[model samples]
Target: MEWKTTSALSNQAIRTVGRIVEGSHDITIFSNTRAHPLSAQVAGIDIGRRTLTLRVFCPAGNIGDYLSDGLVSFDLEKINRDDPPLLLCFEKVQATCERIHSSLFEVRCTLADTLLITIKPGGVRVPFVLGMSASVSLDVYTGLTISARLCNLSVGGCMLEVPLEDSMPLTIHQQLPNIYIQFPNGEGLRSKGSIRNMRPFGRARHVAVGIRFIDLDRDMRQRLLYFITESEAELARRMGMENRRAGISPLFLVSPHDKKPANSNKRRNKLPPMAHAIKEVARQQHIILHCLKNERPFPEDMLYDSADTLLHLAESDRHQFLYALRYLSEEAAWVRHSVRVAALLGDVLPTQPGLVDDAREAVAGILLHAMGKPLLLSEHLPSLDTHLTASQRNLLKHHVEALRRQLHKVGWSPGPVLNRIVGDINERLDGSGYPAGKRAEALSELVRTASIIKIVDTLTHARNGRPALSPLDAYRWVYGNDGYDKKCLTRYVRRYGLYPVGSLVKYTGGFLAWVMELDREGSPRQVRVVKNLAFQDSKLDTVLADQDIQQIGKLEEVVDPANFQL
Candidate 1:
């Protein structure tokens, strides 16, 4: 859904977190004396006082240090997958200690006016602020050396702000053998690029020259993506904050059946606020992935703690948690895969409740099961196709080994149950899986869950590919005396029915709805209509046309999502 937000002070609806109060966010704290950045949280926000509380945290899930020093600088960004996050950099003008509690402190800092930046998804370039500078040097033209500010940065290219006073003058289509850009946070990018476009900026006697990167390596692309996600997410947070303060409706609102309709003017009890919830999850996932990508040790403390938080959630609030997982799947494709795999496992886990005590742990383990992929690929994203090339296959082959080494390197261990879930995720009972083709006899009972995941993974991959299979056909083929154990297959069908969540379906009435959940009798309990003959948001339309639409049994077939515009 498109979110429209504005600050109360401005007549213009500026979608920014300008002077937000009581908003929660994680931040990176860098000190002149400390070598590495410290992780922190915004404990309290007071817009009237022009200050925010920053509570420093240790990696071991405890607050070890607290400070109100003005010398510290913070580098923070919102990490959004679909939209670029807003990035902010600020220093403490003045700080005061308000109060202290166990592992929590209320320190306040006066902030400068927040600076908003738009970071492109996938490192693509949109317009950006021109405050950042970079060092430029030509490969062949050794005599050329110039420092220029940045106008914008995309994965493929970036525009440099050249001041008119600089002596360096180059013609159009100039080849820059090496361009090194160092962010204020010390994140740097070095790439070869060619001049694509150039123009003049007003009043500053500055010229904007655009350069397109020739071919970015895997690591560079991931870095750019992370940077962009961070920037966009921050802006989204600010927008949300401003709207709330102004007493406006939510910006990132979803239209669930229980909630009031978008078209209705009726008052309704507010659904649990979910925009920040998903962003928090995304931020946690991003942090862990960054650690893994940088060859840093696994952040077991953070990962385990995040999982525990989810595990301990009350049964009533589990719906919100599950909804957040669905939103995360839609936000980022990499995350989408993990959430789907995790959801599928979580759905069937309760069928045999004795197997696992906390289903959330299994869900968390499955969600992060693909961490090995990044450890093996080292920032290169894997394709969602079956026909991977030779090198890709080799990378998948040793992913298990890489995951083990990575965990050990991080100086932490996942406990026995979760370790089993994530450790042997790729290993199959029939010995067709990767990292170790151990037979079913030698595998643990937990290996059967891995087998269920294999089918989920296979069906989703093929359904999302060029040549697709209907969900029913895919289900029948994968479970029909296949590699999956008969017991697991029976449990899966009994719980989730023929169509799974994320499955696209066709109806005789010419409507398409995603299968959401199932009943005790294995019929579709809920579905959010995606398309219809009218082509508007179909949720309300479906409500009018069919109740428990799956029970009407007009399901012509389960179809590939690619065939229709969803």
Candidate 2:
């Protein structure tokens, strides 16, 4: 994304331009030295036989942060190395490759697409100095319509060089709400700001409105920052200004402080509930699904690399997990399942420091163990649950083996302990499991540990139009006369207590609570109330941030979503 400026040249001259010589008006030195647009400093410019070579450098030689991807052939019809044209425009050249050559100097009209700015009329451009015009639509809070221009462009919000008459009251500032900078195609850029300083040109019937971006929503902020850093370098290239100083410090938009309610103390006491967290998870999961559906990929590490992250998610820190989950899309269903599975396992695992690391890894593995579903489903329908039909079930039976094969393909060996876990996730100690009919004695600890994940997965979805198996019912089904290894079941109950963490359930009193931590009594005895189902008086009720569970009771009344207040 390098941009250079070309000087005024006549249509009938071919002169070889060279670097500026110090202290003398002498010109005849031929050097292809170029300057940076962010900070005008002479840099090595190599004009390749067929390409424009640009070499950007850091003062400390750390070129790691700079990247550009806007380069094309220099216009061939405009100029030639052997017969250089008199009038030429030297604009910033942007591309990934590292070459600029004499052969590429010819001017091509189509080259306008790669160039960021053009001084000529009707040319789309980025600012060289602190001035540029951005076409924008402004909606005044008073239902007034006005066309606004983003001028006086800087790293912060640009000045809305508005065409307002001096007769307009200066107090117009007080009535202004937040203004949105609409993009070219009517999409709003994240550059939302407020009027910071205003100077009215009454005689000219215009106002130089200074706007300071209060809350930049990521993308627009980055664009402004990039432009700021590149502006000075661009100026140097255009004027052939050789006297360069250190680059100007880039500016940033300051975000406004969020307004909080007057009763701050009560709000501080109310943490976001598990349901809120789960809602975030759902939202984030949908995002991931959307991204995948659009064929976009997120960082692989975010998908299934860390188990401690999952454990922390189940440990009353729903905010972090929810943030993480928003980056995932529904297409990454395996990753979604893995996160929930690991979160559930985190609840049941021993919290002892010595075993925590191992437990986290185990949970991570189980959640992602069936990650081959997407691939499997492409050739054969995916059966992620126990309720698949006979044909679908047969097709789904190959996932464990497929997972092992994929692991090997990627050259990852999580050690034999993990290997054993994957090998027996589908195994039942009663010799009725798929792919393996191993008996109780043959089932290793790793297998039993992996089996807990199966139990949780089964129990979580058992009632959502899939089936209605409670944790207790699930336990009985897995350990009863028709169940698998009783010893494994007993170990699970003893290890994780009765109700696992991350579990959402209702009590006898009709209150709903998510299992937070196992009570000393076991069986998910202690929980956090997510919503007060009985509190129907909106006047008495406050926002979630100003809520008080004690006003109702120790437990929450859980109702169907159709009947829930929120």
TM value for model 2: 0.43
Tens digits of per-residue lDDT, candidate 1, 1-566, equal 11122243221111132322123333665433222356666665555555566775444322222233333455454433332222343433355554355434554565433332223332333333212223344342454456775545556676676643231233357677788876544556788888775433221233446688877889887877665544444333444434323331132232354332132111111223543444444445544654554345565555665555444332335434443444443234445566456655655555465765656667677656766654553223233233556677676767667767766775767767777777666666677765667667766655576466656555654433336555556567767644567776666556555665446666777777766554556444566666775655444324312365744347776676555644
Top-TM-score structure, candidate number: 1
Candidate 1 least-lDDT 10 residues: 260-269
On a 0 to 100 scale, what is the lDDT of residue 509 in model 2?
48
For each candidate in the order shown, give its overall lDDT on alpha carbons.
Answer: 0.51, 0.42
Q: State each candidate's clash count.
A: 15, 44
Model 1 lDDT at residue 510: 74
Residue 86 of model 1: what lDDT?
Answer: 27
